[model samples]
Target: METVSVAIASIGRETLLDTLRSLAAVTRPAGVDLKVLVADDSKSGAATKLVTAHPIKSLDVTCLAVASGNISTARNALLNAADGGWLIFVDDDEWVEPDWLVKLFDCQKEFNADVVIGPVKPVYPDNTPDWLRRANPLYTDWGHRGKRLYTGRGGNTLVRVDFVRALKLRFDEAYGRTGGEDTIFFAQAAERGARIFATDDAIAREHVPQERLSMNFILSRAVRAGQSYGQMRLARHPDPLWHMVFALGALAKCGVAGSLALSFRLFDKARSFRMRQKLSLNMGKLRAVFGRPLAELYKKPD
Candidate 1:
């Protein structure tokens, strides 16, 4: 490994301090060069102040202040600024175990994978609802150790910097707020035959705020995710006829799932939520097949 940069983009000051503190605990083997790059996308530039007041230990850190908002732009800035051979991206609202980077590195060495993926579990703050905890909307896939994966979240992944740069793989700015930039970017890499693998051992934790406890919020996110999935698929085909066929299949799936979800609602809250979620996702896909935008979940809340 020439160098590995842990890239993080933070908008709010709400979670940046804790995230940096957690990174302070990261343990790396001797002679393995590692650095941290944090892009502060907050209007107030709070991340810089926090870093100055309390420096992260043993690691050379670069604090960059980019335009406020636009996560994809922040990530792109991080990629452009990084001089490392590998880039490991983690969300600013999350924390990693001391061995998180080590596990990702080991997985890459073993599999020769171009993209090494990991897991992220939700850490609900106090007063989180019981149902929301059970729903676990924030959790990404929990793949078996060494399992190969083509799709993953950017919150926890180690990407080959050179490969990405060479292929010009980047998070789409159009999705700076919609939150599927990672999906689209990774999907593009996979389409180009880039090897993406999963490491169940490499884990991160996303701190779920109390506001996200709303069932409405969770369902809305799922719907947007489904729409993004469909949009990506349609982008590949880009034919009106093909979109119509895909829309039919998606609509049928949504119909069946919706019926079952309605039935499940009377008896099982968990099953109903799950089914409703599935239905919502397919519905988003259904909407996308026809070329309409999904509900803009990332619109600046006014």
Candidate 2:
């Protein structure tokens, strides 16, 4: 069996501790050599210290100090450092199911996939409103899994080390601070004929911190998502003139969505989320066109 490197890039935050602990306790699949490599992006080297302190015996866990704040750099650091035929990326804030590796590996072999994307469940905080929980305001819809070519979040995904290494794929550092580096990276991979598939059962849980529940956080996340989408579309468009026209259309959508949000925000929970997210996405695309300041969500608030 080939080696599998479970790579996690963290900012050395307190939440990172939980993620590491969970990874340490995960059940290792039989006949597979799996190891955990944590690439730390904190200037303080806090994540490295944390990994050293916990010291999981189930799997070999190692930490490396990488970028100060850039997620792409941190991820790339792990890519270069890890030795694995199969590479699995789990966000530093997520906890994997005990059999996550087994499931992901099984799916990849079953489909002969170059990449396997999995679902990341949300761990809602206590005292959350029932309406918000029902709405699922945090996670995006992955649409029932199939042999689909789609760009997705970094919360949970597996990649063939050969496909990426052969092509020398790296997450764009430019988009690191602003977010969307993962979108661009996977887009490039898909274009290179990488077989990206999804497994619904292989799950990891992402903790939605209290700050992520605020209206401000939701809006910011929506905007970043839109900005990433716009950039992705623009990158793939064949003609520059057509891309410009498409961008204009997206900007117009922002105005329309904003108006609808104002009109219906009082009457509906799901409708409000749908309308507001639409508005935020369009606004983000507009910002991408004019070079607006990015809403850096990963950074600690001042």
Candidate 3:
């Protein structure tokens, strides 16, 4: 099996190690090889000792201490370090299933895709709120019938190494902490007519901490979503109306969902769950419309 090198930009050693353990156990398919580059952005150099000690021989691991915080910048560092034909990305806080690499490779072969994106399921440590679970877009791919190209997701996706190299696609550092770097980067790929594909088979699960489930967290996340969308739209057109249109659409979806959730509190069922989900979405939309500071939104209780 020809080796397919994968460079993963990871921060926080402990979190990344969890992901590495999964990768270490992964059974490489026949005629396939795997290597990992951990772009360690932590100043502590935490991943150095951990990754070096792993017992997987086939897995050539390199942990670079990147003294920076941006995920996009870290990823670019990995792209520069890797010498593989295929590149796969996984977030430091997420773990891929043992068959993850194999399945991703299979999808790449099956579609001959330039970029392949798959599902990202959230793995909560303990019992999670229905709203949080319902709010997650994981466990689903929003693809049109016969559509090959898509807005690529950073986690749980694969890309042809040469294709990325040729296009010089890097997550835009301008997107920064609000985190549309992945979306903006993939948008550029899509614009260049890259053959993007999605499959349900390739899966990676991300852990959502309990802290992230609070209403404040939800609202803050929503604000970030607005900022991301605003940037995307502004990049395409100067019109504020388009932004408002998106904001209104979000609000409507949330209103419908919240209405249903509130109505169904008497009976715990799918509708109730959905209602809570929608309400969250609605609040997000309202934030988008008002263009309030994310910090201020977090101050008011939902």
Number of the top TM-score candidate: 1
lDDT of 3 by residue, 1-302 (tens): 56565666654546777787778888788877788778766556655656766545545777787757666777888778777677788777778888887777777777678888877787765687565465553334546323576476678778787888888888876554456677778878887878888877667787777777666665455556555554555466557787677767776776677767777877665557545645654564466456554332211101
Task: Let me know the TM-score candidate 1 reaches against the reference structure.
Answer: 0.93
Candidate 2 TM-score versus the reference? 0.91
TM-score of each: 0.93, 0.91, 0.81
Tens-place lDDT digits, model 1, residues 1-302: 56878899876455767777777787785567888898878777777777778776686788898854788888999999889788889888888889887888888989999999888888988776676567666676747777876666678888888888999878888888878788889989999888899888877888887777677888889888988888889899988899889889988988988998899889877777888888988988976776676554543311
* Model with the higher lDDT, candidate 1 or 3: 1
Off by over 4 Å in 3: 53-56, 129-149, 239-244, 269-276, 279-302
RMSD of each: 2.1, 2.4, 4.7
lDDT values of the candidates? Answer: 0.81, 0.80, 0.67
Model 2 over residues 160-205: C-alpha lDDT tens digits? 8989999999998887777898988888898888888878878888
Measured with C-alpha atoms, the lDDT of residue 136 in candidate 3 is 57
lDDT comparison, 1 vs 2, better candidate? 1
* Model 3 poorest ten-residue lDDT run: 293-302
Candidate 2 wrongly placed segments (more than 4 Å): 259-266, 290-293, 300-302
State each candidate's clash count. 0, 0, 4
